[model samples]
Target: MRPFKSVPKARRGDRVAVISPAFAAPAISPAIHEQALRRLSESTGLIPVEYPTTRQLGASAEARAADIEAAFADPGIRAVMATIGGDDQVTVIPHIDPSIIAANPKPFLGYSDNTNLHNLLWNLGVPSFYGGSTQIHLGAGPGVDDIHLRSLRAALLEGGSIELTQTSESEDFGIPWEDPRALTSFGNREATEAWEWAGPRKAVTARTWGGCIEVIDEIAMAGRMPPLADLEGVILLLESSEELPSALAVKRWLRSLGERGLLQAAAGVLVARPPVSELSAPVPSAGERAALRHEQRDAILGQMALYNPQAVVCVGVPFGHTRPQWIIPHGGSITLDGTSRTVIADYAG
Candidate 1:
């Protein structure tokens, strides 16, 4: 496994940067963004510092990268977080000065399109958390979910290992930000099923890599992916976005990874519970939703079987595009115990 560096934890009164490296979700919903800031400070006691382009929708890629660079270069800022994921972070990644982050390494919290940044940090040997979105997780819900808060604390203030538990219920998306209830109520939620496990019934613990598979595709096409050799014995984190791609689409993505020898290089794979319904699309029936998840799971397992049958695989752990998400480590350690049917994350301080 590559030696990724763990950044120092932030003190209660420290400052953390909140920037929009992708879509400026905060620009569209300032109320939610303000609420998220309040909750973040109240929960962790760390003040959030926003950059100039944080709320500037359609800010140029260079402008976004400038905020990121300034945040990392600032000694007072102990961590950097994204407001929400968007479609075009691939463009922003190139403008970032790698040396700024390399010199002043700090914890970064985000997922989805932020995967591009995570992969950059991983290559720079800096570790990051994979599931905190200030707008989606902290700002829009009734309150920050307990599981999310625990992992958030682990990644930022506190540092330790915590079991990744399944929440009794999960929601694919929250209510529209324009609705008043979006602040006080959760979107439609349903009972969750146990995570499905496959491959050998054994334990494999290693540092993690991989994120929103859609972003991974873009990174690969841009030639930003790490060498396949670096992934040897690492746990692969794979999750879909709110785009709700079909099962065949997911299969093709995974197949591409496998063909590039990524799947075979990993000791284990961890898949997130995907979102099946888009806010704009008609809601799916419960059975339809279940079938969609099952098809995705089967597609993932088939690819894993073909590439590395001995690798431990677990599907449907809530981490991406799901409410009550766990802000797990990106380049830090995670243990996949197929024998015990458990997942534990290491939040190194």
Candidate 2:
């Protein structure tokens, strides 16, 4: 329940441990992984240090835990970054040594399944970031998304207030790592809509919590959530995965959080841009997709109102499973000003 502590920012020549605590797609896409490493070095001027399981496929939970411990234990490493996110990081949670991570308390960057780690760190009183996957952000095609890069650079090297800007263009269509042509480019993007804000026009600043809705649902089901007292005055950020769950499903998840008193406890909420279409789902016509997205957004707002009528809510801010993501600081100060309709975070110097 204690206020989470922020880790020092990364600097030039600093060492960063890159570990794959979730999926190991990097093993199959070595080309992209290497390119990402090169980009990290060139862009940040920091060395990307990979752990044993960073590129190892089918890496056991114990092995991943060990790498996590080593990353935080190593005094040389200033920050830790996940290569990408997967579905089963929850399995690695039990094996993680809280004291080891808590004692070191270095900034950890990731999203998706890495939500497990974010929650774990928050419970341990260490703040972590909710974005920055090496494959998605750093290795995003020939050039990284400007929004992604800007948010990440600020979170990594400096610490201060960061404004969340809706991107004019964004993508969610993921390419296959196995296909030779997949690396060429598979996703398409279009102009983004402005963020929607609702409730009393007042500004509220507080630390952040929450992550991929699917993953948090799992955490809640497993009864692994932190103390409710810890979440008070925190800003809640939620996003849907590429799976693009049904509008009903999203509503149910939010309702469950409300039932648990989480939604009511937070100061404000920022819902990321959800993926309306995915590779697995049959592509809906443009009109259908837009309608579906609006339905989902409405469902979320209704659920929040049902649980926490006074909660300040903002929808369609860029983050989560979409491209041009902003790296949100887990358990760090976020200022949501309803008067200005702005969602800003003091994430880096």
Candidate 3:
């Protein structure tokens, strides 16, 4: 009924739990996982601790949930993060013990499939982060992107307004994580279009919500998302997954959000750049990639215009499945100034 509450900050040298609530990426790529651990410690001064199922392949939903419960229940665990995202985190949410998580609320950093967990926490009136997967961000090296690390640090350490900026360049795909060399350098990036802003010039500062649109759709369909009323004046932070869904698919997802009154309830909407291709797909030409993103952006804008014309919509924020992702606080405050073409997240660290 009221705003969500943030947990206490995780101090330097604090112990952070690394869990596999979805896919066991650590099992699939231990080398990359180990490098992520090093980054978590050497780069952030945090100790990374793994649970039994953290690296176990084919871990049961209950087993994964148990690990999550154990992470939140452990008073010594100052924070919890995912190894990487997979496709079935929605299955693991029903098994989470809300009481234990609510009782020991701590900073949670993850995105993509982990969106389900963030949505669960939002409904519990607890704030969780929307990015920072260890295997995805930390393991992609040439060092962490300054924007990503700045946002992560503010979310986990310092609590305050961190201005969001457009990444001058971004990667459409990456090398296989299984290859040890993948951890040595970040994915290749090329020049990118500047972030575009639209709608009212009037600035709106409100609690932020939403995540990987695909995950949001699944959990919403399962009747697991927060009440529609809870989103009053909320800033919607939406990004599609690495699945590189078709532009029409992206439209349908946003249309569903509009039909559910979630779009109308929002005061602002921030969309992540749509990934151009998947590792499995043939690499698209630069012009084709640009067109893909443009078409997706237009689809989103069209829906917003039809259903929630009053909402301030900003497109192409770098916080989804794309490289150089930034951390967004679920149910935390953010300022979307369409007139000024800027966004700022309140860490409340």
Candidate 4:
């Protein structure tokens, strides 16, 4: 495995590139996209520059790679953030110029299908954040979530050891950007549960890795992942999409990781709160959703016990498909202190 390098932090008024490495949801929802740009300026005082294919639908992998290249190669752009994630960023990998990204290392942020790019950057020895989509997190209805804003500011501008905290309240319900009513808030939040931990009380600090479970599965199946040895002693963080795979499917994926010898190599693991609702399905009753969440959590822990008995694990972290999502430093140092039951990100100073 290569040593990950820390990208310099973004300063106020610095230009940041927003690219759609995966799907270009921004094309369909110009209002939300515009809102996200405004939020970036209002919240961070940074100007967001959009790439050619950032809002183009059906952009080829080569086109996406070109946009990434353009963003990293441009000296004016201090950081790069994704508009949203989609399937098949894995296809973009082959066309990327590693030399360009390696030479001009900058903080790149996104989650979901952007996992492919995140993992690729990890292999290239550049650290990236695994959360904070402009459309999803920034343009979230009336305003951005406080937790998301806090973590993003810390990761982008203020460099230090940031302690991850679960929001006292959280939500995953989103408004449609097409409907004028989409701008109107449509969901209520519930109290957040404490993070669940397992394994002996030991301290292990290592560079973070992993992303959306479904995305990882796609990479693994396509044989595009880094070598098993490359994952050794790394902290693995994962979360599911709105698709909400059954508990049994979650177990199978973890079991496959164990079988591949990936799970046993990790020093620590963090699981994010999974999204239970999708565009096709209406939100379930509160009681039923809570019960389903518990079942999913247990399935993950059970598989971990069988595969990596000594690995430290935590669950229900507020960092995935849920609202108030946090931006995590991919391939950056994460201190998993089992005793205090806290996860801390040691971002570059």
Q: What are the lDDT figures for the candidates, one per model?
A: 0.94, 0.86, 0.86, 0.87
lDDT of 3 by residue, 296-329 (tens): 9999999999999999989998888887777887
**What TM-score against the true fold does each predicted structure earn?**
0.99, 0.96, 0.97, 0.96
Query: For model 4, what is the alpha-carbon lDDT of residue 182?
Result: 58
For candidate 1, the per-residue lDDT at 246 reads 90
RMSD of each: 0.7, 1.4, 1.1, 1.4
Tens-place lDDT digits, model 1, residues 1-349: 6677659999999999999999999999999999999999999999999999999999999999999999999999999999999999999999999999999999999999999999999999999999999999999978999999999999998999999999899999999999888999899999999999999999999989999999999999999999777888899999999999899999999999999999999999999999998899899999999999999999999999999999999999999889999999988999999999999999995
TM-score of candidate 3 on Cα atoms, chains taken together: 0.97
Alpha carbon lDDT of residue 321, candidate 2? 86
What's the ranking of the predictions by lDDT, best on top? 1, 4, 3, 2
Candidate 1 RMSD to the real structure: 0.7
Candidate 3 lDDT (Cα, 0 to 1): 0.86
Error of 3 at 241 (Å): 0.9
Candidate whose lDDT is highest: 1
Instruction: Quote the lDDT for 130 in model 2.
Output: 92
How well is each residue in 143-191 modelled by candidate 4, as lDDT tens digits?
A: 8878788778877788787888888887776766777755546456778
- The clash count of every prediction, one per candidate, is 0, 6, 1, 0
Lowest summed lDDT across 10 adjacent residues in model 2 is found at 177-186
